[model samples]
Target: MIGLIGGMSWESSAEYYRILNQGIRERHGQTASARCLLWSFDFAEIEELQHRGDWVSLEALMIDAARRLEAGGAEVLLICTNTMHKMADAVQSAVGVPLLHIADATAEAVKTANITRVGLLGTAFTMEQDFYKGRLARHHGLDVIIPDAADRSTIHRIIYEELVAGQALPASRDAYRAIIARLVDDGAEAIILGCTEIMLLVRPEDSAVPLFDTTALHANAAISMALAD
Candidate 1:
């Protein structure tokens, strides 16, 4: 069975849960969905841990979550948050089950697309943080690009104040479009919507370059892992 460690902002977890269940049922017959366990955490604790960069504390939280899932009969673990994947190593070490790395899954998809340079759009912390960039560079060998400082701040603000709060504005889409255009102009062959909520803001129709949704790619990876013998 699959285990979902979610609710790091819950909004994205909703996407993960829905996509996983829906995708499963669509592939299988009626009444078939992923046999799964879910453990949701308090967003406040998660947010604080992220804000302070307290990975030790964060690791403890994820390890505890993984242990509980393991006891609940889950043979695989999905953290359900790309940003929190910063603690992927510690979490994997703590759990007996395989913890699928979201970034790696997306990177695999990115490699298949044959894009040499990819632009990333996500929370400011994620784009600016070395953890995400380092993983993409080290694991995928693809050139990673991000918005300039000004656009990064704008995108970050929109993610926190608008997307997280479930607000969608045309101005937000326009801002993202501008960023994508610049990335394309700068030689980015494709763009990765690093945040799950980002797919809500920008669509392929709005983009001149190819777009990658980390959430969808991660969901597909989880499905493949779950269905594997």
Candidate 2:
């Protein structure tokens, strides 16, 4: 069984829960859902820890969550937030169950999409951090391209103070489109919506460049692994 360590932003976690259960019901020929042990954390604490760069303390929180899930009989763990994945290695190492790397899963999807250079749009911390980018390059041989400072700030603000709070405006969509255009000019064959909430803003239809939704790709990977023997 899988344990979902969610609630980094309840909005995206809701998506994970829905998509995972829906994928299970659709593929397994049952009205039942996938067996999951969930541990949801407080948003305020998570946000505070993130903003202060208190990643070590943050890892401890997730480690405790993983231990709870382990005791509850989960074989694997999935962290629902992309930004919080900055501490993925530390959390994975502390936990008893195997932690699935969402970025790696998305990178695998990018491989199937056959895109060599892909634009990455996510929280400022994620874009700035080497954890996600290093994994994508080392594990998949893909070049990860990120937005410039201004565009990065714009996208980051839109995600935390806006999208994650459940507000989706058209202006936010346009901002992402502009970023995608810049990425294309920079030689990006496609854009990876590295932030789960990003798909709600910019979609493939809005951009001339191909847009890969990280949430969908990650969900598909989890489903595939869960269904496999």
Candidate 3:
């Protein structure tokens, strides 16, 4: 069974849940789906902790969640948010189940496409920090490109205000397309939908470059591991 630590935003986590089941059934034939244990948290509470810069308490909360999943018989663990993956190490250590890193999964997908440089779009924390990008550099030797300050601010704003809120504006989609065009012109071979919810807005057709949806890659990786020898 796979364990899911989700609800960083109910939207993203819900998509992960649907995709995981859909992919599993497709892979193993009719009625064959992943047996998953989902422990979804309150996004408001988690966001409050993040805004306060309380890493210790945040880690503790996630660790507790992972422990609960493991104790309840989940064999593998998944953190359903891109930004919250910063706490992955702590949670993995506290639980007996193997926790899959979303960045690793995305990196492998990028490498398979033979692309070394990609533009990334996500929350401000994910863009400014090394946790996700650093892991990609260290593990896959890929160069990640992010938007400029103004673009980052706009991207971050749209992600939280629009995407998380279950609203998709045509203007927001155009903004993302403009950013992707600039990134591709600046030599990015592809774009990484770094935030899970970002994929909810930006589709492959929106970019001249290929779009790598981390949520799909991560979910597919989990199903592969769950069924692997």
Candidate number with greatest lDDT: 3
- The Cα error of candidate 2 at residue 145, in Å, is 1.1
Stretches off by above 4 angstroms in model 1 are none
TM-score sort, best first: 3, 2, 1
Q: Judged by TM-score relative to the true structure, which candidate is superior, 1 or 2?
A: 2
Off by over 4 Å in 3: none
Report the C-alpha lDDT of model 2 over 1-229, residue by residue, as the tens digit: 8888888777877888888889999987678788887799988899888899898899888888888988899887888878878888888888776888899888877888788898888999889888887778888999998999999999999998898888889988888888889999999998888888877677678778788887877777878887784
TM-score of 3: 0.97
| Model 1 lDDT at residue 214 | 87
lDDT of 3 by residue, 86-123 (tens): 98888877877799999999999999999999888899
The 10-residue segment with the lowest total lDDT in model 1: 159-168
Rank order (by lDDT, best first): 3, 1, 2
lDDT score, candidate 3, position 12: 89
TM-score result, candidate 2: 0.95
Per-residue lDDT, model 1, residue 206, is: 80
